[model samples]
Target: MIGDMHPGDILGEYHEEVIQLYGLGPRKVLVTEREAPYPDGRLIVSRTDTDGIITHVNRSFVEMSGYTEAELVGAPHSILRHPDMPRAAFKDLWETIEAGKIWQGYVKNLRKDGGFYWVKATVIPNVRNGEIVGYTSVRRKPDRRKVEECIPLYASMKAKEEEEVAQ
Candidate 1:
């Protein structure tokens, strides 16, 4: 349900500068509505430094992201962030994990090939010596029903973000 491919193919391709994201810098990225079916029963996992730079990724992560392990490692995990996602969601996530707590939510992920997918993501801080060293994320398939529930919630949150930015 979560990974079901949508009919959104590369029907349109355009470039825009994105500057609102916290970590990922302003740049042009390909956008598409195409959905890449999530590979069932496979878990996508990755580890990132305190700076959010990726340090390792599982094969499942590499495959799901349409990025090779080489391409993913050392890159910011936000590289896969979808613009439709509300900035508030990530803000909450970062605040949670930075407080050494686990954060879980449904995420819309963007693929290298301009396709998209969804995941039930769980993220935790990697702490050592009384300090946070890095973070690890484990994602799995999400319930389709839950994905539907989140759609409007996220849309409203994104609308709020847009309104705030406009002010």
Candidate 2:
């Protein structure tokens, strides 16, 4: 099991780089239209602390994310956030999970090589001793039809987010 520790303790010197890589870029960094390839019958699993820092990940998760265990174990789960993903979607996710409810949605994630992948994700709150400890997220291959349907919806949401940010 992954333990909950301070971000500073994990990030250390990589903090600055992470910010620059994930924050300094454009809100929507469209790298490629290509979808990441993955085998069937595989599940991606990961755990994060209350603050959303990664604590553990399964082999499938590591392979799908294109990041090594050492590189991911201490990083904020946001490192996988794809620019194509709408901010509203994440907002909904946080709101749901913080309310102690499961949030199930289609997510687009960025790979280490700047590629992208789509997943049908379900994020659940990890509760212990009547307190919310962190979160565990399990992802599987999203149905192609569902992904196709989400594309336009997510695009619209992203547009709205941009509009709000510009105002």
Candidate 3:
């Protein structure tokens, strides 16, 4: 599970010279299957355009969501958005990714049966030749303690954003 992972637990931590050379670098953590059992947390990989339309989703993603690939391929990714999730958080996510940067955080997603699950997600902008082409995200099960801490924050943020939007 991703929650069980600490920053120090990452394998093959290395410095990227390109990032240092360009002064636009962030320290990278390389994870190997040997280091962790292929991340037991359910993984969902997707590509979305600037407008947040769903373009693609992996098989696991479709299975986990209880939606067939055909049903989800063209639907908005927001189709799975949980009402408990804060709109502000997603807003922040979009803003961060749109800037061509990565955003790492915990998210609570609703399944087809309305059951909720937690994931530690790292969202990165898919850039091509310095252009923001789209976005990709990798998510894994989050630690229970971390999810506990995030719930209230998300609830509060959701309430505030919903109130604002309602006005």
TM-score of 1: 0.88
In model 2, which regions exceed 4 Å deviation? 1-30
How much lDDT does each candidate structure score?
Answer: 0.82, 0.76, 0.62
By lDDT, the best candidate is 1
lDDT of 3 by residue, 19-117 (tens): 010122232322222212223746878787766667888876776665577767666566556556676677788889988899999876544433445
Ordered by TM-score, highest first, the candidates read 1, 2, 3
Report the lDDT of model 2 for residue 117. Answer: 88
Clashing pairs in 3: 3-143
What TM-score does each of the candidates earn? Answer: 0.88, 0.82, 0.70
lDDT of 1 by residue, 133-160 (tens): 9999999999999999999999999989
* Residue 162 alpha-carbon offset, candidate 3, angstroms: 4.1
Clashes of 2: 0
Please name the candidate that would achieve the greatest TM-score relative to the true structure. Answer: 1
Clashing pairs in 2: none
lDDT of 2 by residue, 99-163 (tens): 99999999988666556788999999999998899999999988999999999999998889779
* lDDT for model 2: 0.76
